[model samples]
Target: MRHVYGWLLLTPAAILLIAFTHFPTLATVYESLFSKGSTIRPSRFTGFSNYESMMEDPVFWKVLTNNFWFAVGTIPLSVGLAIAMALLVNRTLPGRSLLRLAYFTPTILPMIAVANIWLFFYSPDIGLIDQILGSFGIAGHNWLGDPDTVLPAIILMTVWKEAGFFMIFYLAALQHFPEELEEAATLEGASRWYYFRRVVFPLLMPTTLFVLINAVLNSFKLVDHLFVLTKGGPNNASNLLLYYIYENAFSYFDTNYAATLTVVLLVILAVLALAQFFFLDRRIHYR
Candidate 1:
């Protein structure tokens, strides 16, 4: 009777998962295997043509490079800033609450709101960044408008929004670290930097690994700000895989090929995830 009740309790969630997530995933895989023109008609089984086309598509390779660069730009900046912020906030500083709230404000702010605010900062002439540069007798080109500056602009926004969130994770890990370890090091007259590097950092390895995986995933998934700030321009410089997929599916009405591209992105994410589970999971040592 208890087993029956347990099954009944789990049934609704299982049904919902199958109806929405699992079923749609299977459907997409099926659709990706099919061939269809970019028309309003149904698609037919096209077997590997789309995959082969993707291999030859220069734009596909370009966008993949952009996504890779995005991850590279955001991951270290955000995670390192988070660790620095955590180290600051974990201290005995006064007005820490105010500092924390300021750091975390962008995390709760809507992506559109943050992007709009950043856009104003990146604007030429009257924009704050430009105004400051102009005052210094340095010319300021449009931050999001220039091909060379667009990706960096987006990367900067992403780090600001994400660092605070990752900081909280570091704070929790810091709390779990034993005070006795630090005290022992202090008694030995170990330098602050040496003690932290040898003791504290190794203890926080698990948390750092978690943050790295999360930062990579978020870098690929969250590009909404880029949509408003750069729109994958000027000339596909900021066009990451997900945004490009969105443009192909909705803007150009290429649902069939869009599905194929989405599957490719999924494969990339899956590889990242599997790497974490295999490598990071093994590397976390217990004290």
Candidate 2:
């Protein structure tokens, strides 16, 4: 009777997951093997033709390369900043609550709104950055207009937005740390940095891994700010894989190609998940 009730409770969630997530993913894979259809022509199976075309597409390669650099640039810096912020806010200090709120405020705001605000900050001549530079006698340069600077500009905004959210996770991990460990370290005359490096960091490994995975997923999935800020502009300098998929599907009306791109993304994510399971699972220290 208990097993029957358990299966009944699980049925709705299982059905929803299959309908919404599994079905769409399988459909995308199926569609990627075909060619786009029109009124005169219907989609026909081409058997890896779309994948071949994707390999030949220069824009696809450019965007894929950009995504790699984007992940590399943002992940470590944001995670590092998060750790720093978490450490600072975890300590007892004056106006600690206010400081915590200030750090986390960016995380709550919509990315579109935040991107719009950053647009002004990156504007060439009349922007806030330029205005500040004018006072220092340094000539203002175009921040977003230049191909070289646009990716970095977007990366900076992403780090600012992401770090605080990661900080919250780190803070939660810090709170659960046993006070007796700190007391023992103090009795051993260990320096704060030494104690943190040798004792605290190992205990926080699980939270770090969790945050790292979230950061990696966010790198691929969150491209809303790109739409508002750069639109992958300055000759595809900041173009990311997900944004490229959007361009193909909506702007160009090439659903087959978009499906192909999505399949590639899915494969990449699957590989990452496998790696995390095989490698990181062994290292995580659970309480």
Candidate 3:
């Protein structure tokens, strides 16, 4: 009777998951195996043709590489900044509430709003960045138009927006830490850096693991900023994998190819998630 009741309670959530997540994922997989249908022709089973095409597609490779670099650039910097900010505001400092609020303001803003705000910052000649440079006798350059700078500019904006969010988790974890640990460290005459490195850091490992996973997921999933700022423009220089998938699905009206890209994306995410769990699960010291 207890088991039946438990399942009855779980049924709603299970149904929602299957309907929204599982069904769409399976449908995408099925679609990837077929060809894009039109009035002149119909979708036919093409087996691995789409996959073959994806392998040969230069734009696909370019975007995948961009995604890889984007993840690498954002994840560590954001996580490190989050930890640092959490440590800073966790102290008994003046106007701490205001500081925390300021740090978190970017996180609460809608992504579109954030993008729009940065759009102004990245604008050529008359923009904030260019204006600062202009005052220094430096010529203004198009930050978003240049292929070399576009991805890095987007990465900087992403780190600014994400650090605050990750900081919240770290701050929460810090608050729950036992005061006794700090007392003991003080008694032992351990330096602040040493105490943090040896004691506090190990204790924060679990939080770090969680934050790392989330940061990685966010890096790949974010596209709203790209939509507002670059549109994957200037010769697709700043394009990431998910945006490329969007371009194929909607802009080019190639849903089958989009499905293929989606499947690949799903596989990459799953593998990375599993790898993180497998490796970090061992080191995490759960309280």
> For model 1, what is the C-alpha lDDT against the true structure?
0.85
Q: Compared with the true structure, what per-residue lDDT tens digits does model 2 show for residues 48-127?
A: 99999999999999999999989999999999999999999998999999999999999999999999999999898799
TM-score: model 3 vs. ground truth: 0.93
RMSD of each: 2.5, 2.2, 2.2
Model 1 lDDT per residue over 1-287, tens place: 99999999999999999999889777777777777664585577889888888789888988999988899998898888888888888877999888888888889998888999989999988899999999999997888888888889888888899999999889888877777877899999999999878987888888898888888888788978876888888889999899988998889877777888989877878898897877576433333
lDDT of 3 by residue, 29-102 (tens): 99999998999999999999999999999999999889988989999999999999999999899999999999
In Å, residue 92's CA in model 2 sits off its true spot by 1.1
Extract clashing residue pairs from model 3.
none
- Residue 33 lDDT (model 1): 78
Off by over 4 Å in 3: 1-11, 276-287
Greater lDDT among 1 and 3 belongs to 3
Q: What is the C-alpha lDDT of each candidate?
A: 0.85, 0.91, 0.92
For each of the candidates, give the backbone clash count. 1, 0, 0
lDDT of 1 at 197: 88
Worst 10 residues of 2 by lDDT: 278-287
